[model samples]
Target: MRYGSVCSGIEAASKAWEPIGWKPAWFSEIEPFPSAVLAQHWPEVSNLGDMTKIADAVRAGDVEAPDVLVGGTPCQAFSIAGLREGLSDDRGQLTLSYVELANAIDAKRRERGETEAIIVWENVPGVLSSKDNAFGCFLAGLAGESSELQPAGGKWTHAGCVSGPERVIAWRVLDAQFFGVAQQRRRVFVVASARKGFDPAEILFEQDVGSGSTEANNVGVERRSSTVDNCTLYRFRRTDSYIDDGVSSTLSARDYKDRRELVVMADNRVRTLTPLEYERLQGFPDGHTLIQYGEKLADDAPRYKAIGNSMAVPVMRWIGERIAAALPAEKLSGDYGGSKTPPDQRDLWRTPPALFASLNDEFCFQLDAAAAPHNALCRKFITADQNTLETLWADYLNVPGYVWLNPPYSDITPFVKKASAESRNQIGTVMLVPADTSVGWFREAIETASEVRFITAGRLAFINPVTGKPVSGNNKGSMLIIWHPYPRTHCHFATVERDELMTFGAKLLARREAA
Candidate 1:
């Protein structure tokens, strides 16, 4: 099959389809850096300068119109790094041009005997994420011309504008890591076809996000997901998995900086992969072509830009091949699996440290006595499930012993109520929680615990499931609140700097009440 590629990133489309005997008649890349890599590697291909110029030029070419047009446009303007100007913004508008060009191609194909042609495109995941449907609006604009966008009457926007489906865009957000990319890189796909009813939905899949996929349950908590079947390929292999169950590993940004914070296959001890490895992990073939150009770039530049900018070739090809199969072998047009585009893959939660603890005066009785010798501390070693949080409840307070508590954030209201009820009892409990002081739970924990020891620090120490070692410098800090043995309802107030809080949670645990 012959196709045309524009705004291609590192030629992922070329590599993905080349093995299938797919050939590219022409291609374009405006960026000199990636263009350099493409030229160095695939030197025989012809180049088109810009999408706007090439869109019409290709349409009018003496050669036949491409059955498939593939592009993964640059998305920095809408990325986190910049003000999310979207397609309306100048730099980001290139995406709109792609849609227009594809529409033009579809129209030209329609003028001829051709009834079907497919246009497959990719972009950052942020496109589909917005509640405003900003990206959707762009796709609607692409389906027709400026006329349909601004309908005259109440019909289809513009009364006299170009109407009907000139081109169809069916898209979904996907993570490269899910397709076997080592790092959690997300990209949105916009699959536009001149044919009606073409669907991109069949290729969409899901996998667990975040750390801890080997423990058989939630991270530092009980199992939340249902029975995990091992057969499902989340991304590709060794990709997305839950913290406590599946054998797959989490791909964190820390892998870029910390060598120890990586997943090593026990069989080979492949010390995790370099950023280059991360690229390969994501299905980019020999992106090492860009590596030689690194010396000209800054130290943090190569992997930083390459990984962020790359598309998982396997996932892309999977989507592309699906589109290709849906269409007639020589033509591009099919009904899309009805759906929307996808969003980016940036990490949502940066884990914070455990700060305040709640306890049942009975369960914590031993702990209180340990702080004051009034309660028995020696016999309080209670068996607790590592999956379920260990907590001090009301019944434990009645027992004449010290209480040990490690509670989950869930149902904190009951724990606070139990601790508050023991204002006069000789029991105290400490718990871990986020540092948000304004929350009612913190207020309750502070109001009831006889004495509060607010451990301040920056990053907290965590076990990187990827590395199984202390996520040392990677911690943002956490808290360990130790309530005094005495029974008095008192709440102390203080503030913690991020760095100090990080250190205090991971390295130092001073009583904030001290000074």
Candidate 2:
């Protein structure tokens, strides 16, 4: 199979697919260092330079379209690290360019009566939340329906959208560690094919296939790291589990400057990975991105940037192998069972220290504490073991004081209802729950609570009870629902973003603390 790769940082797609007899026909890149890396290795392949011109180049006969189009576009636009602008930012518009180019390729294939090319794309999980259901529209576009995107240019034109029965599209969040990489990198991979009898879901979603499969029901297996014989294997972060086995944390370009990001033991001595080690973690050849421009490029920052940005070679290879086998193979599309709707981001179970400190008060009663004490402010606590649901309604509905309620994630309606009722009784209560707008309880809290503060610090990282460490992080946004018994003069209910939430919560907590 041949490939035309976009946003081709060091051409990870080429390295990944090469072993399976896949070849790169062209690469799209602009960065100097990564472009040099591509020139050093896949020098024969044409460097297309810019992804925005792919469709035009193909149409103008300046470049030949390949059987496969693969790319991990710039993730910053949708990354939580930046303001998730989705298609609004100029960088975000590149995603639209990708879709447009693929549409153009499909259009050409139709004109020539040729098989439509396969499309594989990758991005951070934040894309799942960007621009209010943008992923849903992305799914629609791949299925040959209109994407309903704005700016007119990003729209899926009927001519570009394929309408036949042969099309199949699927997406899933896959971890790199599961695919034989020794790093805990989780990314969203989307696969689509406009060919008949080919199910992209079957290729991308199936688990424990072929020989020597390590697949299991254990999710902890992904986090499990094994120590190398004489080398110091390391895990970073006080919040992460201290495992006997050595598994490396996810590598980011920014980790070079952050000691906490790359804490490691080499031969029992603490050190960070050399550029070569970083390359190997991503399944790249040693010095693939480095040593390209000789001493001029010897600096590690560019190497780290290139390596971190590239896709995991082994993960892509696994996907490529499946694509190869499934080309002529038969599999039912829907039987594989993947979600068309992106999964909701996981919620942080424990509130962060700063957050807890910012919201604490005197005489606070925790209505829904678990066996594990997650909140420090709760002087009087009700545990799940004590049938807290029954207790909340019958025993303590009118109990006065600053009440902190981090109720059970499931079945929050009754608790929300109780809190709403008790607010009328002049009991001040604050509840933390997922900001899932679809749920009835979420709506109930918003409608009934005196004020709702949407946490804009993105997501909270919760502490793990079993490991006594912090879990990596949860993507699900949280909301603080406040029900003050005394009516406020400013407004009945106001929604505040991160800064406002932090500022307001901190002032209140500080006042109580000072007193």
Candidate 3:
């Protein structure tokens, strides 16, 4: 299949694409660091220097038109990495380069007798909003002033030469971690193609789904830093999940040399990811990032810059898979062009399975029963993608036999002390807290836990499910604690020592679980 790439990096994608039997017809990239990485990795292809030079290529026709083009455009203008002035911002305007190339490619492809080619566009979720546009008028001329495509699916396609994807563009949000990547990354992708004979419904459904699309509706098409989906995701801020040891992490600027964020649980132990761990989080093949690449940059710069600019490969791979499923076989010719997967007989919009909600309700009901007395319960049944500490807290509380409280190691001393004291001031409870022996919270928990163990290291890790072993060594932060008071003779019924309970200074929140 004909394919082209722009805003290319070290070409981690080359691996994923090569397996699909797709060969790159063009490669475009910029910057010294990434170019070196790309050159070191993909030395064979025609490495076009810059995407901004695309308009010139179309004018000159040096860049041959292709049937399929894929790119994650330079998104600094739309990234949290910089001031997010969407289109108006110079960097955000880079997206227009992709759009310009799309238009140019299509026009030229028609000239070359190619009927329809695929256009895969990926970018930061923020670009979907107009409020972030910066360069304004300059962008008007970039992609021919076409409006942003609707972010729904199953609403556009062809019905046998009946004005197919013709001009209809479709888009959706997707994530990498769920496709088995170690990190949590979300992206938005848009697809546009000439209408020939396809179903708009299937096209819309594809864009509306295929991984990580459950979240678009949660947001109100507004723009205030397209960060997390909503405030429901802010529970990490109010608690200790941020420096989680096993779960891979976000690449923050400060954490470039090393994950500046360390997981410090209740025992004073600390854990954070190494650059190697960061590589795994981004879905690279094991040891894919050369040691020199990671080692050459002092500290975590290699890891930070490499992953920060990279797209969640799994998400894009999923897009490729969806595209593969929707498109006629690459060799489709003669008859299939006018063929139709008609309106009545289609599998694209199958009704969602009833089992997930049915089974999850049972899990929630059982979990809720167990965590009943302890006011900490999770709110609802969230999917695999549902890890917001707030939602988890609300939902966890609903489960039976558990009071899952993971408070931020630094800001949780007072809260932990309260949850601790409220356990009948002596009844047992389990808390997955930071092991920061130095932090007042850990000290408080340590001073009290009838049993405390070094479960694992966090702050950064690959994360083992049963034993909680981190992929990286245990040089970071955090440990788990299980506090159950020993049955001592009646000195004080459910005796809770004031020194141990000393961190308890705030009002305790005693609310019933949400039924």
Top-TM-score structure, candidate number:
2
The C-alpha TM-scores of every prediction are: 0.47, 0.57, 0.51
Whichever of 1 and 2 has more TM-score, that candidate is 2
Residue lDDT tens for model 2, 1-515: 66789999888788888888776767999998888888888776778898998898676434655678999878887877768777677887787788788887776555433468899989887777676555555666666565543323543221122232435767777777776667778788888888767777777655554442224434554433332335645666556654434557777767657534343454456666777777777887766876647667558888887788889888898889988988753232212111111112112245554466566633344443332355444555666557554554325434455577766554567778777776776777777776656656766666767677777634454454334454332324577788877765432544556555456667776787899
Write down the worst ten-residue block by lDDT for model 3: 346-355
Q: Residue-wise lDDT of candidate 3 within 200-291, one digit each (tens)?
A: 33543534433333334323322112121211111123255553323344554346644544444346555555555555556666554553
Q: Where does candidate 1 stray beyond 4 Å? A: 62-64, 129-133, 145-164, 196-273, 290-300, 329-515
For 1-515, candidate 1 gives per-residue lDDT tens digits of 55778876567788788766566766777776667667666776666657678656545532335667788766655665445766666767777777767766655454432445576777666655433345555666766644424323422210011223555445555554444343445566666655555544433321343432222222354322211122221222334333322222333333345433234343534343445554565566544545456456324444545454666677767766665566533311211111011111011111333221122312323432111122112243333232112344334445333444433333345545654554335454554444445456666666656544443533343333233333332211234444544644455554454454444443323443354
Put the candidates in TM-score order, highest first. 2, 3, 1
lDDT of 1 at 2: 57
Clashing pairs in 2: 225-245, 225-246, 225-247, 226-246, 239-470
Model 2 has an lDDT value of 0.65
Q: Candidate 2, after superposition: displacement of residue 470 in Å?
A: 63
